[model samples]
Target: MESKKKEKKALGLAELVAIALGGMVGGGIFTILGVSVSIIGFMTPVAILIGGVFALLAAYSYVKLGVYYKDEGATYSFYKRTYPKIPFLSSMIGWFVIFGYISTIALYAFTFSSYMISGSDLAESIWARKLIAIGVIAVFALINAWSVNGMGKTEDFLVYTKLLILAAIAFIFFQNGTMPVSEFFGKLQVDWEQSHVMSILIVSSLTFVAYEGFQLVINGVNEMSQPEKKIPGAIYIAVFLVILIYVVISFAAMLAIPSEEIIAKKEFSLAAGAGKIIGIWGTRLVIVGAVLATSSAISGTLFGSSRQMAVIAGDGFFPRILARRKNGIPRIGIITMAVTASTLILVGGLELILEFGSVTFLVVSLLMAIANFQIRKQTNSSTILTLLAILCLATGTVLIFYYEYTHQWEQLLFIVFIYVILTVFSWFFSIREKRRLHREEFPK
Candidate 1:
């Protein structure tokens, strides 16, 4: 009976780390690779490494808070609990985080669709891609609604299998190099001087989105054993692994593919590069890897973010219906997230979705860092490290907006508009909750 009970609890450290990696390694890498290469040329790996450093800084506070609170509510819960007096701030974080996940869901689904149709006649058809994006979200939302154990096992399989495939792809790039390794290094040195320092930092800031999903591990605090240990361990290990995978893959893509072509097919650069270098089979393999990567991302995001949404709704910060769950799974929240993400995919372009997700998460992570810093003594966190985390995240947030302002001012305005709308809704809910509390305190 003891053995059977242990077997039923399938998400050990390995599985939890897999969830984090599955979430972190999705469409962000595929989408950002070409853009990074275009901006920094062969020095793209350097930018990726810098991005990893920023991710580590951001993770420090998250791990501290995760260990301190041990709430499955993760981001929103931590903030709300830390400063109970500011209910509106917590509501804003909840809305921002959920919508952030929604945007990334759209991002992963769009990337999946891009690679799904990479070799087909409908590859250039925007409507066809959008339709497939919606279909994939619906499929994964159902999978999440079905069972937690099933989602864990599926995530483990997809995460590890995609890692293997990505490793194999990297190996192929090195073994069947179109250009000599020396030539690639030479290009890097030449590009190094031509590339502005700000450009590399900007690219690094953009890559933060690739590291967004590692926090999903905290959402599994309810199911996992010894979360205080597992949450921090899983998150740190997962972030390191994702950095390795991304750096290796980015280097390989640059070595195998020309910069011009990479920039040309920015949406599906990996597939395009593999097709050019290794022919049709390589392209097909990359497509398979991308499909698995995005599928697991969609699954993990829906699973984790929906639970947070349900928790927020229970607190009266969102719709009460979202609080309903079956067997500990938030089915309605999952479905609602899927629908909203699908709507985003239909209406928004890939760049808009990606940038919105990136900015939203950066802002949310910055808040987490501040929350952890406020309770650093209680959480037993290094105050210096926590403050550094705050500094780095704050800088990254500013850099992202600066990048947008310089390059795409229109999109910057659109993002600002969205934040305003979310803040207004959050304020409305917070006020209502306060009034209700006041009534309960002294009933008329």
Candidate 2:
């Protein structure tokens, strides 16, 4: 009986990779392209590669702590266990990380809605998109609540299919390019010469959110087989593949489409660009690819992050009801995530959600790196790499803030206000936990 139970829980590498990639490739490429291009033009791919470097650095500590702690709570669990004496810090990380996940989910769902309606007469209708986004989130939340195996199989199909479609789109654009690849490189060189280094760096920092989902691999520690091997294998492989996909596809898009069009269309730029280059069929293909990408990402995120929510709840940092599991599914947590993400979709704009998610994840990953550094010997992490992760992540966080402050101070204030709310809630939970402990120790 015990053996059967263990066998049932052993998720293979392919499924794990699907989870990571599904969580990633969803909105990262689709969303970052226009924004990055608007800032650095042809240097978008270079900034993407740099963001990949940030992701790699961040992954170093996540992989280390994930393997060491083996907790489904992931970012929150890593921090809590590493600094067991600081309950407030633990609660705070939990709030930030969960909302960060919520923000990403909102971004994915909104992108999904954008592409879904890109060809329609109502494409410009914000409420229409919000309604579609809410509907998709609810659908995926139900899918996740159904069964883990069901969600994994669905993710495998969506993720692999989207990758094939996306690769084909890139190849098609490459073959039909208006200019030779060499000429494209020549233009990139000239564009780089004309661009500012700080703008490039800031865009790279912004792209950090696109690479945010790689750490979701750690959130599945309990389900996957061989934590020691699969955790690092899935994470590293998925991150590398995503970087390649982003660069190749972005290069292909820039090669074939005009930069002004991509910048103007924003979230639906790929479909719009493809429409101009290859006509309506190309537009449809891009839309299909995007919908699939964001769908898988939404599913993978709801699966992993909801479990993490349950773990945090079990630690008394959230409502106790979230801790309950039925058939190994965190049903309440899953539903809560869907509703909250839907709320964010209704309340936030695309760029606002994007920047907020990038900042939040960068900050959370930086904290994870710090926690890993604190227990490097136990996690068997290299001191140099861990410190590098911290420094790079800190720089990325600051760069985003600087960009927001200089260009959009109102957005910066709203982000800070959200953080203040999260901190207040975290503080309340931590204090309540302390009172409970005191009651136990001192007697009522």
Candidate 3:
């Protein structure tokens, strides 16, 4: 009877989907819209869709490893278990994955602040945005630290409400757009001619960061019901839904807003463009959607990543205090993540944070593909599909690097520098863990 009650209380498909969607749909569309539109023009949806395809490929390995191991540590856990001989490798993944999530957290919080204050005079003040971003992060951290069930329910509401609002936004824009369907196709043709294939591919790869939240599904395995079914089911469904949402929303924006205006407004493009096309109420609605999108994202990311952080800490890769839990919630890990993300928002520029996150997740996902490929038979993953995933993910990582090299070399250097710092931390912890093991074995 107790077991049945526990099973009943575990997260079901709906809550799992909400967690994944909450992670993916945050400030991603809002943050990428202006940047993608600037690069690919009317072909932004194509690039976004291509990004989703890549995201699906990345999820393949995650799903297999997730079901096979059923560990909430996720990427870090998978690699560690797959290659137990090399402690440093797992440590590297653990550090990179956690910081990758932190970068996304910072990205979402910053976007939240950007859209939150877009209408007010404070929008122009960087400090004001940073403070607000930090404030929102703190709020969600507390919510997550409160209880897992409360966080899940809140995420469900925020994610579904934002989706409905986004759908309505798309429909309204499509209905009000002056561009004919034929003209829309014509614009795409022109965009194809003017934009290089490499440029569109780069944008597509860059958009993968927006899809990084899918693995958060696997992170909830411990608290979830039926891992074998729900892990893959919820992840794939959420990814598909996100792709549809991003494509429809991007399509609407392309039809109703001018490319130049989108690029100029950047983070504020949706609300401002909607207001210009429709009215103040339209602007307010879009703002509400964006705020909801980011808020849920903050909550979901904190919920999943903090758990992973606690796992890594318990494994001796991070401060062990983070492993401490109050009523099964990793309060210290949640607080640490919130503080680090807040710091990143205070110091990092929006473009830098976005690009950094994209690159980090691409690297992490590629590593996951490699790990799954090695253990394909054990995980029951298709060898061919895993190989294809490796190839596609590798191509994405290279393309992003090439784009950064050609366009933003400074950002590339900064990303490299941050990795160096993380590598040092990982190596230190890996060595410490090794020594601890050695002491345990020898009893000197």
Writing each residue's lDDT as its tens digit, candidate 1 over 1-444 gives: 775445435468988888899889887777888788878888889999999999998888889999889888899999999999889999999998998898889988988988888768998999999999999999989888987788888889999999999999998887766878799889899989999987888888899988988889998787778888899999999999999999988887777777898889885778777887779998898899999999999998888899899999999999889999886788999999999999988787657656778899888889999999899899998988988888888888999999999999999988888889999999999899889889999998
Off by over 4 Å in 1: 1-10
lDDT of 2 by residue, 144-263 (tens): 888778888888899999999999899888887787789888979998999998888899898888887888888878777789899999999999999999989999988888888889
Runs off by more than 4 Å, candidate 2: 2-10, 348-350
Candidate 3 per-residue C-alpha lDDT over 215-272 given as tens digits, one digit per residue, 9 for 90 to 100: 9988888887779999999999999999999998998887888888889988778888
* Order by lDDT, highest first: 3, 2, 1
Would you list the C-alpha lDDT of every candidate in the order shown? 0.88, 0.88, 0.90
- After superposition, the stretches of candidate 3 with alpha carbons farther than 4 Å from their true spots are 1-9
Candidate 2: global Cα-lDDT?
A: 0.88
Between candidates 1 and 3, the TM-score winner: 3
Look at candidate 2 and tell me the lDDT of residue 254: 86
